[model samples]
Structure formats: structure tokens, C-alpha cells
Target chain A: MNLAFRDIRHNLGRFVLTCFGLSLLLGVVLSMIGIYRGLVEDALTLARSPQADIWVVESDSRGPFAESSRIPGDTREAIARLYGVSAAGAITYQSVETKYGAKKLRLYVVGYELDRLGGPDKIVAGRSIVRSHYEMVADRRSDLSLGDRVPLGRNMFTVVGLTENRVASSGDPVVYLSLRDSQELQFELAPPAARREMARDEGVPGINTVNTVIARVSPNVEPDLVAKAARQWKHLAAMTQMEQEIILTRSVVERARKQIGLFTAILLTVSTVIIALIIYTMTMDKLREIATLKLIGAPDHTIIGLIIQQALAMGTIGFAFGALFISSVKDYFPRRVILQPDDGLALAVAVLLVCILASALGVRLALKVDPGEALKG
Target chain B: MSLNGSHTLVEARGISKYFGEGDARVDALREVSLKVYPGQVVGLLGPSGSGKTTLLNVFGCIVEPNTGWMSLDGEVVYDEGWLRSDLRRLRLEKIGFIFQFHNLLPFLNCVDNVAIVLSLAGFSTTQAKQRSVELLEYLEVEHRKDAFPAQLSGGEAQRVAIARALANRPRIILADEPTAALDSARAGIVMDLLRKVAIDQNAAILAVTHDEKIYDRFDRIFHLRDGYLDIEQERGVTEMTQD
Candidate 1:
């Protein structure tokens, strides 16, 4: 009964071909959105897993995630002495390449106090790093199973615990180590340098330094107040957990988000133009038919409805196909592609809006066709 | 033949239509006066650009004439270059148009092409389709009702279009070169069908064509030359038979 559906059915092959092209374009757009979201999720997972309310870093620094901020490991005790600070732990983060078997595995090595507010939030396998040295907990994505021995700088550690989906914003799997061993490994001096320093009457080698100190405020006290109180220490800068996340997302990965956003806008604009051109061409092909309809006294709204109905159908069909395509092959992608249902719904709505906007060109062309053409035509 | 006599269904007096502005202007119709009576089939003949199409447009209420007094179904619809009501609604409710080509919607089948007019007139889909079947059967194209416009033969397509024009049961039917695409035999068939429809429904019909073979089929004929009336003819039954 609907003219749009009738026309599409009449030209089923061409309609399907157009929808396929649209679906491929929509699939790429959806993947970009997923990549952007996945980066944000990866960034947040590590921040949320530690469950610390505040971070205390070296003075005049943005913290370890955004920039290097090495402070004395004893800063944990200073932050723990504050009134509302229930727990504090010195933490270090560094990217390291370790050998699994024959392949090199890149990991985000996180050194945390085992008894304090830093470690994996959930353990799916054996146990947390129990030994003070030569013990590790690996994320499942690292392809390391429990009971495997991995060699890092100057030591071989046994993987005792396993976690899943714990990764850095760069998509590297996270591996946990005891705070002491991590600090020693991160700032270890080469044997030659150590002997040279000894001959030159230098002090002890760099061993007791950590990237930052993480703390959790007592439930009754506001974390912001504790952070502000800790800021009074001239040797350190204290930030609440929310502030650290803002820094990570807004400053640390700001450029990536902006580039992806620009690409998304260009894709959407291209989609709109392509749809307009296709619909306009379709209207042109039926110029005489439209003129005849006009001469037969068809209302303008009816003609408009034909164009918009076709547009809306194409958009809805294309979005459905795009969502299916991205979800089915997302795992094959090197980086995580997280497609949430809300984002899919939002994209569907956007596609519909674009379709409606694109149909305007066809509607304008159809309305401009003079009914008088049917007389001699 | 509802009253067994002539009753005016459409009247146009001194209707003029001009295009462009000033030095570039050209008059398409120059004070063209015309009448169509119920149960009659009128023909308009002219060479190319002689204003026959313009006059049809004026009668169909598609283009406003520069100067005109037009009445339809006893209502003063157009007076001196303006419409008294919505022209689109007037055309939908009271006038049917058949073009040079069949002009059937290519996407729709023959039945749907006819039923669309009834749907536009506010009939439910089921009612419109039922009425469309009856109309196509009346035009002797019931067997081709389910075929798409592209699938239908030329003669069949024209019959479907005529059925569509009559689907609204309007008081007047205006056809422009309706038989131009058909051969002599097919053109005779279409001409006969038009005559039958006008007499059966008591509706006035006006057709513009240049088919000499079908000249005797018209109840009245008007010819135009250089945007002016050139000749008028009305033949008796005996003369029509002789032709």
C-alpha cells in the first residue's frame, strides 16, 4: 500500500545493493565509536580496580598515569598519618616486556602494597602475589596461566594469580608485583654504575623510590578534604580519585579522543551527502512519474512521505546490518572494541535523523517537477 | 444521459494565460471560451504550441488563467484569474485527467494504479480495491488487473489509466492525447471506450488529439490556430456514420 515500499520491492536488487554499501559505511562508524569507548573503559578499569579514594604524588606533577612522579616510598607513612586517611600504599607503574614462552609479551607492570589499598580488585585464579619477591599476578589477556614462571629485569617470577580485562589505556595487559620487588626492579642500578658510584663516594643506590602513594579516606570523611589536607605537605601533591580519572581521560588521552571525534564527524557528513545524492538520483529517474502523480491531484505530503519513508527504511536496515557486522568480528581486532547497547541505540537514532535530513533533497526535486509536464510528456 | 438532454458540467469564458514578463511575455491562451455538457465527448485539436494544452490546464484548475470566468458543477470556482477554493481539492474531487501516455505508476499493478485515486478520495484500502476491480472489469481489463504497469500491453495500460481517471466518478474528465501512442485499431477502441464512459456516467469528457482516423467519434470538436479558435464541428449521427 505504501508507495515507498512498493517502489523498493519493484527494484529489489538495486535497493539491496544500496543498503549493503550503506551498511559497510555504518559499520566503520560504529567501530570508531567502539574504539573510542574501549579506550575510555581501559583507562577507567585500572583506576577503579585499586578502589583508592585519593592519590598523593610528588609536588608539581600530574601523577604516574599522566607523567612521571617519583617520590620516596616513605610518603605512604606520611599520608597514612593524616586524620581521615584509613589506608595508604606506595604504588609504581611501568611498561615492561617479559618472555612468556617464545613470544615477547608487553605488560603494564603495577607494583602495589599487598596489605594496603592497592592490588587486583578480583582474582579469578590461584592467589594474590604472596611472596615478597619473585611473585606476580597476571591479567588473563596476557596469555599467562597460573603456575607459569615469567622473567622480568634481573628476576624470574611465578604467576600465582589471574585477573581478566585489567589493562592500561594503551591496551597492554596489567601484571601485579610486590611493592618492594617492583621498586627495586623499576629503579635498579646497573652493576657497573653501582661500582662507579661506590668509588665516587655516592650514597646508596636508588632502591626505595615509588611512582606515587595511593590512599583511601575513612567512610565518614570526605576524600576531597583528606586530599586538600595532604596538599599542605610541601614535598607532595594530593589528588582525589575523581581528579586523577579526569586527568587520565581529559589530558592523558585527550588527543586520541579528539582525533577519533573528528573522524566520526567526517564519516557522518559523508554518509549524509551520499544518502542525499542517492535519493536525488532516484527522484530524477522518476521525474515523469512524479509529474503524472501531481497532475492526478496527489497531495504534496504524500509525495514527501514517499521520499522520507524510503530514507527511514534504508537507515534502519543499514544500522541493523552495521551493528551485526561489528559485534560479530570485534574480537578479531587487536585493540578492544566495546559496543554497548546504549551506543547502538544512540547511533540508530542518529542514522534516522540523517536519513530524514537526506530525504529533503529528493523531496525538493520531486515537488519542483511541474504537473504540466504530464500534458505533452 | 441522466436527464436525456444536455446539461453544462463545465463553462469557461474569456480565459487567458500569459507567461514571462513584459518583452519576454507570451500569451499561451487568448480569451479562450469553451463548454462541456454532460453525456458528451468534446475534442480539442491544434498544431504544436497552439495552446490546446494550456486550455486543458486552465479547465483542469492546474494553472490560473490571467482573465477567466469558470464554473464547475454549478459552482463559480474561478473568476478573473483566481480560484475560489483549493485548486488541488477541486481537481481531486471533480476532475479526472488522462495524459498522452498511460502514466500509470510503474511500481504498482493495474488494480492499484486505479485504486490509488479512490484512496486519495478518502476510501479505505479494502473499499478502494474492491471499487478498482469493478472499474477495471467495466473497462474489460479485469484479467490484467494484477499485472504491473510495465507488464501490461500498451492498450491495456491505457485502459487501466482511463479506469483510474474514472475511479473518483468526477463530473468532468480531461484527456490530452490519450490515444497518441496506440495504432489506428487500438486508438478506435480507446475512443469508443471514452464515448461509452461519458454517456454511461453522464460525465463530460474533453480530449485533445490529432488522430484523423477517430475524428467522427467526438460529439463536438474545436480546433485552435496561433492561440485562437480556428474551427468548430458538430456532426449528426448520420454524418458520423458516413465518416
Candidate 2:
């Protein structure tokens, strides 16, 4: 055993080179897994941080993404009158392509009541929005620093604060604005269209409404009861936080999840096949030496150990490189690539298992070698 | 021809080995029996395609004979059947083999290559290394202990192989054409070292060779023709000519 390690160390260059190649493969696999996890995390961060218990949206619609839900803005006031409702806030959501410098950025613009219920949970670099309109708190991923003016619609808004990883279900970075500003963005028509439509409606513009009303129940109250009570209203359907998340996952992002899952499976299979081939090649290179060792009375287990140790070493080296490579370049990716310690640890263990399994080819070859071959001239 | 004081270290009784079966069957060794004793250096002389190597393989416990009983140190190791499944371990502990080419692992230095067998036999690394250094010094290659096999000359490499074979202090040393690759002078030097190690360590040695010059130096010579052993006794131990 000691001799085996020493032999590898003595040939450090070859071993390290082999390990480096394995590492690159491992790194790509790790990055893919991280990206998949990051997508799910980024989708739910905005929803989770607010700590709302229930969401009221249009019936038969996936909230904020799959379809539009416009309810009377006064729904918050009505929901707050319910027995278990402690607080309620109306929110508006829309995705828009806006310009920042030379780039056209796609942002999920969220309109919320700043004083009562909605905003970034924490500001990473700047202050939260203080005004009712034209002030924005951008997710850091949007690359907007404080005081940077972004053109949205026909108006320009100054970025007041920067938050981290707050993205919508589509992985678009979020920009938070006052409820009134977002409502106008969501429902306001062009001036010419609005004027013509109002002329037909006797000079009265359409009533103001919101996509959904998010509600928080009292600490002692059951969120399910509050959601059921809100659902009694015919024009609205209320969903608890859990139900809303499920709907978002199953309805809005299900396709993306499946795609990421398929990618993960393909990468795993590729990794396994590559490792197996590498081990098999290395074993073949040492076939004569293995037979010689057997003839000289080195046990079969020794030969097996040598091959297994080499495989494990390759896996360890590959994983280290992969983790470092992915983490160093994660930010450059279009979507968030979250590299967590637990994820890396799991990948390391998984790759190790793959290596062990991959080395079966080598082990079988070594075991089948004929000691008599060593005596042949 | 029987040297009484040098009790038998290896005994092969009516050993026969065949390959394939039916029409394709080939008899590699046919009813060959030989004995090598302690304090003796026996050489097996044969041409190519002869059964010298086949007989050596049987004696080394590397190949099972079709029919025979074989003993090492008066213990039956084969009796028309295998007595042990761990043949590799048996070879490691009881038999030492030296080939024509010095088959040292290239990745390891001379000391490490020599020490590997001891290490495999469960000796501590320090003990194995210490024993290896001692053997290298005995073989006069201690100065090149740190050099890899590739860094050594052909003669130095062969010496290192000899040192490695003696590392485990086995009961038998089997040298398969150990000097076939060397010149006359280098071959004489290697043969002298083999004889010295066998006498000093009190271990039996069987060397297979086609070289005719060193035949008189061996204590006994066994010639294999077609598949049978023909024993010849040399007059006495004589110092090898240094040239």
C-alpha cells in the first residue's frame, strides 16, 4: 500500500496531469448541478424573504407569470377585515425589457406597498426605496449600482438600492418599485390609446386593479383557514404560501426544471463513461506489470487496490478542479449558479462512487491476468 | 551425483505438464523430475523451445503440473493437486525469481524496488527499507540505491534485481536466464554473485542458462532435452575467470 502511493508520488507529473483532466470533467458536472439548484433558489427567494402566509390571485391562474390576475385594489382592505387576517398588501408584477447603458436588460418589475408589506428584505449596498414612484431597488444581478438611471417605459428611474439574488420565476433579476408605479406599468395604456378608450367610455378611465393581494395571517391563526375564507369571494382565489410555490413550480417553471433535470442526467452519464474508459485504459497500460506482480507473489488484492486507488485519486483531483472552476466562473453565467458546500460535498462523494464503479473494468482485467505470461520470453 | 550434506530443498516427482487437449494437446514437460538442495547452484541448460522454462515455472509454483508431487523444504506443495490458493503469497514468502531483464518498476528507485517485496509481506516500511539497503550493500549496489532503474547500467540493474530477490530471504532463488542479456564478463560477475548468495545465505538456487562458459562454475548442471532432465556433476567449485 505504501509502495503504491510512493510510486504515484514518484510519477507526480503523470498523476497530476491525469487528475487535472478528470477535474475539468468533474467541474462541468458540478457547475450544472449548481446551476439547477440556483434556478430553483432564485425563483423562490423573493417569495420566501417576504414571509407572507397566503396569496390571493385570479382563479385558474398561475400567480404573476402564466396569466394576468387583475382584482380590485380594495381587495387588501377587504381581506384585512377577515377574522384571522393580520395584514394584507396588494402587489403588481410584470416583466419588461429596459435599457441600462449599452445593454437591454430583462427585469421582473414588482409593484408593492412599501409601508405595509413588500420590499427587499435586506439592502446589500444601498438604502430601500423611500418614495411612492420612480425609485427602484435592483437585484445585484441586474448590474445596476445605486444612482444609476434606468429607462423603463417612457420614464427614467434611479436605482436606489441593490439586493442580491432576488429573481423571478424566469430567472430575471427583480426590480422593486412603489405599488402605484408598478400598477401604472402593468395597466397604464398609451396616452393615445387611453384617450380614445376613455372617449368611448364617456371620459372615464378604467378602474385601478392589481394582479394579486398577498396576505399575512395572525401568528395564532391557521393560514389554511384564511386562504379558505378569501377563496369564498367569487372573483378571487386565495392560495397559501406553500400552495403558491407549488403552483409556480409545477405550472410556470416545470418545463425548465425538466430540461435542467435532463441535462443533469446526461452529464452524469457522460462522467461515468469517461471515468470508466480512463480506468480501463490505465489498467491496460499496466497489464504486463500486473501479471509480473502476480507471478512474483503479489496478491490479487494488491493489484485491485492499485487500480482502485488510482481511480479514486483521479476522482478526487477532478472534483477539486471542477468545484473551483465552477465557483470562479459562476457569476459570469446568465443565470445564477449557486455553488453550496453541501452540494460540493455531495458531488465529491458521488464522483468517488462513480470512480469506484468505473474501476470495475480495471479490477476485472487485473484479476483475469495470467501469472504464467510473466515467464514467457 | 547425490550430495548428501546439501539436503533437498526442492523435489519434483514424475512431474508432467500438458497444454490444450485432444488433437491440439502439446506436452510441454513429460515426466520430468529433479532435485535442488541447499548450498547448491544448479543450472538448467537447454535450447529454445525446450522444456527448461516450463520446468522452471513448475518449480517456481507459477504453473500447476498435470500430474506430479512436488516438495519444498520437505513439505509437499503439489500432489496431483494444488495445496494453496494463495500461490502469489507462497511465491513471495518462499520463492525468489530473477529474469534475464531486470524487471524493476521504473517509477521506483533501486531501494524501493528492492524493498517492495518485504513491504508486501507486511513488514514495516522502515524495516523493509533497512533490509533492502543492507542487501544492496551486499550486492555492491548500495551507492546507486537512490537511482531509478532507468538510470543504471544493464549490469547494475541485474545486480539490483538480485538484491530484490534476496530481500525476502526465501528458501529458493529461481533465476530464469539471469545473464542472457549480458556480455561474457558481466555474465560471469552475475553468476559469481548468485553462487556467493546461495552459499552465504544457505539457500538453494536454480539458474536456467544457454551460455556454455559458466557451466563448470556451478556445483551441479542439469540439462533439459526435449522434456527430460540429464544431470551432470562438475568436479569442484572453482573461481570464475575475471575476464
lDDT of 2 at A177: 91
The two-chain DockQ for each candidate, comma-separated, is: 0.62, 0.54
Candidate 1's C-alpha runs over 4 A off are A98-104, A143-151, A156-159, A199-204, B1-5, B237-243
Q: Number of the top candidate by TM-score? A: 2
Candidate 2 CAPRI grade: medium
**Which CAPRI tier for candidate 1?**
medium
Q: What is the TM-score, restricted to chain A, for candidate 1?
A: 0.93
Runs of candidate 2 with Cα error greater than 4 angstroms are A198-207, B230-243
Error of 1 at A46 (Å): 1.4
In model 1, state the lDDT of residue A83. Answer: 91
For all the candidates, what are their Cα RMSDs to the real structure?
3.3, 3.4
Which pairs of residues clash in candidate 1, taking residues 3 or more apart in a chain or in different chains? none
Ten contiguous residues minimizing lDDT sum, candidate 1 chain A: A368-377
